[model samples]
Target: MMTQNLLVELLVEELPPKSLKQLGQSFAQLLAASLEAQGLMNQNAVVTAFATPRRLAVHIGNVAAQAADKAITQKLMPVKVGLDAQRQATPPLLKKLASLGADASVVPQLKRELDGKTETLFWDSIATGTSLTDGLQKALQETITQLPISKVMTYQLADGWQSVNFVRPVHALVALHGADIVPINILGLQAGRETQGHRFAAKVNPIALHNADSYAQQLSTEGAVIASFAERRAEITRQLTSAASQEQLTLIDDDALLDEVTALVEHPNVLIGKFDAAFLQVPQECLILTMKANQKYFPLLDAQGKLANKFLLVSNIRPIDPAQVIAGNERVVRSRLADAKFFFDQDRKKTLASRVPELDKVVYHNKLGSQGLRMHYVRAIAKMIGEQLGGDALANQAYEAATLAKADLLTDMVGEFPELQGIMGRYYAQHEGLDDDIALAIEDHYKPRFAGDELPCKPIGVCVALADKLATLVDMFNIGEFPTGDKDPFALRRHALGIIRILLEKKLPLKLDELIQQAIKIINDDAILQQWENSSNSSEGIAVRRMALTLTNHAYIAEEVPVLHKKLQEFIYERLAGSLREQGYTAQEVDAVLGLDPPLPLILKDILKRLVAVRAFAILPEAISLAAANKRVGNILKKAKTEGFDNLSLEELSLHLRSDPQEPAEQKLYNALIDISDITNTALSTDDYVTFLQAQAALKLPIDDFFDYVMVNVEDKVLRNRRLTLLANLHSLMNRIADLSKLAT
Candidate 1:
């Protein structure tokens, strides 16, 4: 079989910077997949994708000029309907054969087979393979139709009135099978061997590709363009590093920025530019964000990672003098920085406390009230959480912090850059001469903003952060604004995960249920006022709505409070389980540890400690047997309840054990549990769960003997209840740290 490398390209106007990389890769993969499906390429074929600001191309190796012919089986009419009584060709068989380009002479060669009690006539034939031209054409069409384009542009074709939609206006399409043009058309452009190069830097206007193998080289050498997106990005990185090294600074590394820059230029010329030192007075985060987000420039940092006055920008043109490009970019960036500094200076004149009232005008949600009302809830919850964790001092600090957390939403700086919301609050709070804890808390309340992000560093911040997230969950859930499927309009899932992360990672002495209750109380306290203000425009209408909402919420709170709390708790635990599994805990292990019933769920403060213990316990030599025994014990207890032993409470069963005679095996098991109870209880009290599980491991022999020699479902009522109680006691002791039954395979 003969094979040749294939190349295809589509020249167009500038593509979307963010989607360019994905588009280029998808094009190549889809084309190659279509070819393989048609038997034109093999598994060993390699695909190379090329994407630039003005073009998308691909080079595939080991693609055949034509696919191999395929053998196909065709079913004709049934035997009785196709043949006459004398077994001669009938009119139906003759007509079918004629339609297949065969005549009556070939009807005798047809094979007969039984298909579901019906004798069917079948024919075997070879279908001609598809040529490269046709296969490439189909593949190209499929690739375009399936391209993951978030948006498309419509432009008139050469016919003027005829318009087509594409990611960008298409200029040229090139398709080559080895040296021959595999003729095709896409986006109203006919395939050809000629494609234009860099607008200003190419040596030639139209660089004619000689073969599919030489597309990249020809473009780079003659056209002065980096044809491959990866190669172009690498060149930009190298240039940035070299330029930054010459200035004794480091370029901030952001992969997303790198990709966007790569898609914005066919040829990159990294240049260092400078802004006035006065702009550095603004916070580095503000300056850095403006440069990266507004100007698409990379800010340089000093040895200690402090933002330097100088920045780097990539230009598409490489002029001989290059001074004009460098100066032009520096001027544009200076203007952006000045605006940022202006916002910073103007925002500082008004203290965060004064801005608090302005948040009342800014609606946080249509159903929920404004940011002002939400802050009230946050303040209440934060103070309560602080008091629970510490005392009145911490409570006061947390209250103060929560009071001004959203004040920056009204600040000019944060208004211009919403990403700087909490950050600007911290800066403004410090400028207002607030305490360090309160200032940090204002900003740190939004910490762990993303996955793997750090949580608040101080206790004040932790209290406010937890309260803010809890308020969001409780309020949103109260109004029936829960997340459905992947659509979480309020980011309720993120708030839940944030809550779990703080509780588990910070080792906070907080109960999940207690926190939910605190948030619920705050939510209920302000429900009428908030709902009324949001529901109506006039004071009289507001009063009417307020009363209605109060009456409705009274009923809602009574019925849905426990239900929503459980759901939210389950949501948080699910997110935690996913996070833990991603961090390397097995699903079974996570389930086992989370399956433990909490007395106050404040015990969840020790969840991490228990998880570590569970992992260690799982590695014990007797772990499998113990886990199986626990599962068997659970089944026996479940069966006992079904058999009229309805009162399965540990307390009730313990009372029955007082008068009930225990079997010999049960007595021994009881003795073993009693022996380890003291040590296990001491270890648990000291948060030494690993030691507790290890102590419980000593009961393996007695538990195994109890299961082996004892019949838990004996005929006598008293005997069964006593054995059930013994198993319950054993179950409770073994699972003091985790649910061992969940660990059973």
Candidate 2:
């Protein structure tokens, strides 16, 4: 088989910057995967992805001109159904062979094999290799079809009557095998060697690629474009660093922003721009966000990590003078910063407390009433959590923070930039001479907005943060807005994970079930319901009134609260299981710890200790035998219960054991359990799970002997019941730390 490097490119209108990186990587991977599946490319072939604002391309090394032929064996029908009494092919066999392009002459060549007690016939054939032209066409079509495009645009082709749907309108397609053009068509465009590049700065209008290997070099030399997304991003980073170093400042580090900028320009030329120093009076968050979100510029920071007056911008075209370009960017950014400053100044004119009344006009959810009503729920929950965690002082601070948390939604700064909701509240609170704890809590309550993000640093902040996330989870689950698959419009999974992270990482002595119950109670309180009813009736909007009525109706909440608690509990545990696995714990270890039932309250603070203890116990020499023994004992108890032993009290079942034990194995096991009872109880009382589990290793020999020499199902009813009760007690002692049976395998 002859092989050559392959290059493919699709030219179109400027692609979305945010999705360009993913789109390029997907295109290359999907194309290479398709070729590998078709046997036209090796599994280890090197695949390079190229993406810019206007194109997505890939270069795959060592793709064959045609795939190697493969030998295949396919199963036919069973011999009993296919062969006649005389060992001749039946009509069905003939039809099957005919469908496979075979005839009766080849019937003797069919192989016979046993397929689950019945002899089956097998047909062997050689499949022809796929030519590069056909393979590339199929791969290209499949890749385009599978691209992770969120939205597709439908547009008419040059023919005017024919239309095609794609992420953008197709302009040209390039496909090359070595130096030869592969004859492939996609999106109504035929493959060619010509492609347009660098709309304004290209040395040549249409750079004619000479071969597959020359694609990148030719684009750089003649097209005035850096085709590789990563390479372009590196150049921008290098230039930004060099420029910032010369000015004694550092650029704000944001990889997502860097990737977006890389996708926005083909030739990145980093240039310095400046804004008025007066704008620094506003919060640095406001200034940095305005620059990044609106103008896509990198805000420079000083030595102390404070925002500098200067910023860096990447330009698509490099000019010799560069003065006009720098001036133009400065002008645009100055206007944006001015707008941000104006919003900030206007917002602080009134304190956050004064803006609380306006939240009623803002609907949090149509079915959940207004933000004002939601605030009431959050304040109550926060105060409850604070009271539990701290004393009345922390509770008062949490209530104050929760009361004003959503007030910033009405501010000019937050209204213009919704991302600044809690941030502006913090700033406004500070301006009003509020306590530092309260101000910080207002901002930090939304802490851990995503995975691995920090939790609230203070007790008051932790309370409000927990309350906010819990309220969201309970309310969303109550309304049946449960997240299904990847469609988490309300981000319930994120909310659940946030709550789990806070509870576990903060080491707060809070029980998962308790917090959930408290949140449900607060939301369903009659006082809160009455408040919601009054607000809804006074509001002018009919939708608001109807939603409030639905929410206040006690019957709807009563039916949903129990289901919501169970579902939310399961959801949180599921997230915790996944998080634990990601942190490198084995599935068996996680399962054993998480498999506890209703008696256990799922104390988040102690889950890690339990998992650590389980991991340590798993490595013990006696762990496997004890785990298996536990499983056997469980089965015996379950059988005994099924045989009407369930109604017998432990005293009734163990009545004969008070006198004497008939079996030595049972006596040895019973004595061992008694010996370890005090030690295990002390260990458990101190929450020393490792010591508790380690103490059980002493029972391994006796437990194995009991299971081997003792017949638990003896015909003597009293003896059998006594053994069953002994096994039940052993099961309880063994599983106090974790379900050892999950580790049996």
Candidate 3:
């Protein structure tokens, strides 16, 4: 076996900028994986992926020219089936051997082996390895077939009658092993040593690569291209930073835009461009979005974090005089900014309150009615939450904010850029001279849009945010739109997580179950259902009428709402558990804390405290023994209940016990429980979970001794029930903070 570095490249028309990064990565990964699976490449081989606007290429080190030959043993038919009574070949066995490229002369050499209860014949042979030429052909075909191409283009090749489908039109293919060109063909292109680079700035029209190792250097020097995506992005970052620093401005940090820009250019030249300062009169968010989304330009911010007049553009070409390029980009951006300013000016002509009627025409969901109906549900939910949190004053403010929240969906600015829905609402509300709290709530209601995003900054905002997210979650789940596996089309998981983050992070006293019930009640109200039926007779209204009928039918609502509530509760807790584990808590610790009975407090804020207490208790010297004892107690109580002791009460525990201990171990356990009962109660009263759990250490010794000496299932009925009552009290005390038995390994 001989080894050599290999290079593979596919030259095509300009690729999609947003998908180029993934395309490049997948191409290289799939190729290398296929080769390794065939034993033509080592697992530790170094692989480098190269992606530019016009090419996808890869270089792999230490790839064998041919895979190693392997020895194989394959089971043939049973001996009786393969051989006649005289031990001669039968027609079926001869045909089977012929299919394997063997003949009857070798039948005598076959070995006999027992397979299951029957004797079987086995064939041993050496399999030849696959040559690089054939292996690379298969790898290339598999890679192309498996590329993550969302959409494919069907184009005819140079041959008039033949057509091929690919992400882009393929122009050339190059495959090399060291200095030799490996023969391969794909997409109507043959492997070669030539590839075009840079499109216009190349020193050579088609640069000829010398070898697998020289491909990158040759392309960089002669083709005027940076072949590596990461290296190209780094260069762009360096240039942008240097240019921004020269003018004492900061560049807006967006990795997605940076990657897209990197994929759009081969030779990145960061040029500073400027627009009229008057354009900055628009909100910085609006201006920044236009620049980045419309023109793919990086906007710079001044010292106060305000948008500056200058922006940085990544150009594909560098000229001796960069003034013209700068001016050209500035002209394009100025046009985009003027359109944004025009939309802003037009939208401010009417207040957000006036835009409320327009949302009726916008369908939120077919089954949920229009945005107008959803607005009512959210308003009702928000008012209830506000009343619970801050009484009448906050309730009025939240109602007002929730009313105006979706009003922005009709504004010209938001219609043009849907990302600015809540954002534009805040601005319009402020322009109308509304209360600062109400205006802030309009925008912050959509806060924490993604993971690690900031929550609402004010109490009013928190109330409305929770209301909006809850409304969506309950309605979607009601319509059977909950997420299944990785398919969360409605983002229900995100909505649940957002609600959890606000409640826990803000330490709001609101209960999770209560919020869900409030949402369900508001959406299912008769008045709300009547409004849906009377609103209109359009298809949306028809759908809403069906839904309203389902909600108003007392039998259906009674049966479904509780089930819906339990589902929503479980959904939230699941999200919370995953989030806790991600925060570094072990699964056992999370399980122990969350496994309490439903009647117990499931307050989101207290969950973290309980988890912290569990973590601390898990490290104590007596923690393991206590956990095991708790588990044993739980099992014994469960068994007793199933044995017709379900009504055993702790109030009658003393009644069943003798004046003195019937068994020494039982008395010791009884005394231990008495000693810690008051201590645990006092600790629990003050929310001292750590103290409550730690106090259990005193009972571990007596518990172990009792289990060892006392028979819980004794023949005497009175003694058995007495022991059951004692264990029930212990189980109740041990699980007050968490189900410690879950911590038992």
Q: Output the number of the TM-score-best candidate.
A: 3
Q: Write the per-residue lDDT of candidate 2 for residues 1-745, one digit (tens) a residue.
A: 7899999999999999999999999999999999999999999999999999999999999999999999999899999888999989999999998998889998898899998998999988888899999999999999999999999999999999899989999899999999999999999999999999799999996999999999999999999899999999999999999999999998889999999999999999999889889999999999999999999999999999999999999999999899999999888888888898888888878888888877777878877767887888899999999899888987888999999988888988888898987888889899989998888899999988888888888888899999999988877766667788889998888888888889999898999998998898788676766766575543544345346536654323567667667877888899989999998999999999998643478788799999999999999999999999888877777777777763345566445665766888988888899899899989989999999999999999999898779988888876777787788888988988889998998
Looking at candidate 3, the ten consecutive residues that score lowest on lDDT are 547-556
- What TM-score should be assigned to candidate 1? 0.92
Off by over 4 Å in 1: 74-123, 526-556, 597-602, 643-663
- TM per candidate comes to 0.92, 0.89, 0.96
How do the residues 1-745 of candidate 1 rate in per-residue lDDT, one tens digit apiece? 7999999999988899999999999988999999988889997899999999898899999889899999988898999999999988889888898888878776767899998899999988888899888999999999998999988788899999889988888989999989989877878888999999899889997999999999999999999999899999999999999999999999888999999999999989998889988888899999999999998999999999999999999999989998999898888888898899999999999999988876666666655656676787788889999999889999999999999999999888988999998999989888888998899999999977987789999999999999999988877776667788989988888888888888888888788877886677667664645554664343343344235435546313566667767876777778878888987988888888887765336445677787899999999998888899988888887787677663456556556656664556666787788788889989978989898888877888988888788887788876776677777778778877788888888
lDDT of 3 by residue, 1-745 (tens): 7899999999999999999999999999999999999999999999999999999999999999999999989888999999999999999999999999998998988999999999999999888899999999999999999999999999999978899999999999999999999999999999999999787899997988999999999999999999999999999999999999999999889999999999999999999999999998999899999999999999999999999999999999999999999988889998999999999999999988887877777888766678887888899999999999999999999998999999989888987899998898888888889998898999999989999999999999999999999988888877777798899988889999999999999999888988898788888776765665576444465466456548544312657788888888899889999999999999999899888864464788998999989988898899999999888888877777777874457556655555646888998887899899899989989999999999988988898999889988989787887888788888898898889988999
**Residue 742, model 1, lDDT:** 87
Task: Count the clashes in each prediction.
Answer: 0, 0, 0
In candidate 2 the C-alpha lDDT for residue 675 amounts to 93
Q: Model 1: clashing residue pairs? A: none
